[model samples]
Target: MIKLQNVEKVYRTSSIETLALNNINLDVKKKEFISIMGPSGCGKSTLLNIMGLLDAPSKGQIEIDGSKVENYNDKDLAHLRNQKLGFIFQSFHLINDLSVIDNVEIPLLYRSSTAKQRRDLAQEALEKVGLSNRMKHFPKQLSGGQKQRVAIARAIVGKPEIILADEPTGNLDSVMGNEILGILQKLNEDGATIVMVTHDDAMAKKTHRLVRLFDGTQVM
Candidate 1:
């Protein structure tokens, strides 16, 4: 349930201007799993950031669930993102000192939920990622696969409608990457819309559709 119309992103300095995305018009339907693939500097991540509301377009419109987001203030965008989106990054952005469950609970801290509610929700999310038994362990104690699973748990702890994954498997071995892909597949089947940016062709092939970018333009 996301749409971008004639979107463009540009980074400007006193000496030069660079266009990151050019005339991007995309629509992602509910529960659709989309893969965005491109070479480095081809705007895949930029497009994902705009879709995730992590960044804004220099020009054009963005709509989430039929609501225009182009005019939203930062506070409103943050509220909307917290309520509607989840993010999975390749680096597994977990706090080194926090236990698995504690990391998952971080997102709920912004919501109006009780500690107990947050704990329960975090537990459920961990269970979904098969990490329930590791809840008390610190990130350093986990394997690469387990750490990525922890990241997945944290993302879904908020029960977001859409999941934006930026190279979720980039840091893992092939087998572990496959495991993460299976987890994402199951999430999509269970009704979460997923838009992933990946450099791996094999990973991209697993999604419902592939959208390729080149030189900041949609090539396929």
Candidate 2:
């Protein structure tokens, strides 16, 4: 469902040029769950951002569900990302002020939907993450696991075709990390294509395939 060809990313400043990715060529199939593993500064997140269309590669081509993303302007890119991609991060990027359900509803607000529809979808998403009872709770009131579950709910609220999770369980304890992996496995079984970036070997092994990286190169 996604393809990257000869992808290379470079960050340039007046005095330095850092290569974040080098010649990355990957093809992600429909409904497949893939994990990317690498040490710190290995460009895993950069690869993910490029895959999700959040950041463009300095050189190469990206094809999402067969459509080549080439020279698209900001508005066009935003629309595509909203329609096709969902993101999760290591840190729950929840608004401390918004209730859990309200946080999930944020994605739907950008779409043409009634408040009731948004509420119902948010409720259902929380249910999937086993957070239905905590709908009214704020971020500060939840445990770290609960907060990450909230982040997952927010990501899936839109039911995007692909889920790009950047270290979704990074902040949790071993037990909590395993729990989160179980949830992700369930989602994949239910037909969501997922690409997760993780530093944990056990976590990476649970996915369908593991892609290893070194420095900025795909080594395995």
Candidate 3:
């Protein structure tokens, strides 16, 4: 489980100050699926990044499982990011030059696994997303939905406990969006905690809880 207490994010330049998140408190239970909804500049992605430990909060604390993140060093943060969390972005961040399976294996490269282990895990992850047949394909050769599935496969290849997805269905058609959402739901059912940022109300409704934000503050 992940917990954020009185979290606030502020970005400052020489003369400008912007508040990205304001006094946010959230408790994500184990295996729970939650969706975050907000306008274009309402800090949905900012909150997610703080939760994923990719960014530090300016005025509050982050607790993962039970340890306070403030006490963790850079090396500790890297370990948590690599071994405890998985990420899926709205834009598929696949390397165009790598094959589908190789793209999925990117995360494993940070760990100390053998080549065979990486390939087997990537194979299983691609199979989970129904992309087993396309492992040999390239990113440019696949459809948008297929590309996103490959992204999902890459995210889960590490078997991390928490999955942080940012507008995962934003680039696809309704049918493809539904397919991607169904895959996320199945992953939740199979015991991965998910926190998703979405603009679509229908997609937000499918999660167990919906947290709404406005002007960088939790409104609902």
Candidate 4:
């Protein structure tokens, strides 16, 4: 469902050129669960961002589903990203002011939908994450696990083809982290393509395949 060919990411300043990724060639098939594992500064997150269209690689081609997207303009890329990708980050990026349901409804705001429709969809998403009863709760009122569950609900509410998670369980305790992994496993079983970047070996092993990186290169 996704392909990256000879991808390279280089961050340039006036006097420094830091290469984050080098010659990354990856293909994620539909419904596959893939984990990206690497140490700090190993470019795992950079590769995930490039795949999700959040950041463009400095060189190479990207194919989503089947179309080449390397040349797509900002608006085009934005549209494609909205249509095909969902993101879950280490930190729950929920608005502290918005209620749980409201936070989950943020993605649907970009689409043409009625308030009722958004509410229903958001509610259903919360139910999937076992947060239906907390719909009215604010971020500040929830525990770490509950907050991550809220983040997961927000990511899946759009039903995107691919879920890109960057250290999704990084902030949780072992028990909570395992619970989150179980949720992700269920999503993958239900046909969502997941590409997660994690440092935990046990977590990485739970995914279908592991792609390890070192010094901006694929080492395993």
Q: Estimate each model's TM-score.
A: 0.98, 0.98, 0.99, 0.98
Candidate 1 lDDT, tens digit per residue, 1-220?
A: 9999999999999999889999999999999999999999999889999999999999999999888997799999999999999999989999999999999999999999999999999999999999999999999999999999999999999999999999999999999999999999999999999999998999899899999999889988
The deviation in Å at residue 181 for candidate 1 is 0.3
lDDT per residue (tens digit) for residues 129-202 in model 4: 89999999999999999999999999999889899999999999999999999999998998999999998999
Q: Model 3 shows how many backbone clashes?
A: 0
Cα lDDT listed for each candidate: 0.95, 0.94, 0.95, 0.93
Deviation from native of the Cα of residue 125 in model 4, angstroms:
0.7
For residues 44-156, write the lDDT of model 3, one tens digit per residue: 99999999999999989899877799988989999989998999998999999999999999999999999999999999999999999999999999999999999999999
* RMSD of each predicted structure: 0.7, 0.7, 0.7, 0.7
Question: Which regions of candidate 2 deviate over 4 angstroms?
Answer: none
lDDT value, residue 93 of candidate 3: 90
Candidate 1's TM-score? 0.98
Q: What is the Å distance of residue 37 in model 1 from its true position?
A: 0.3
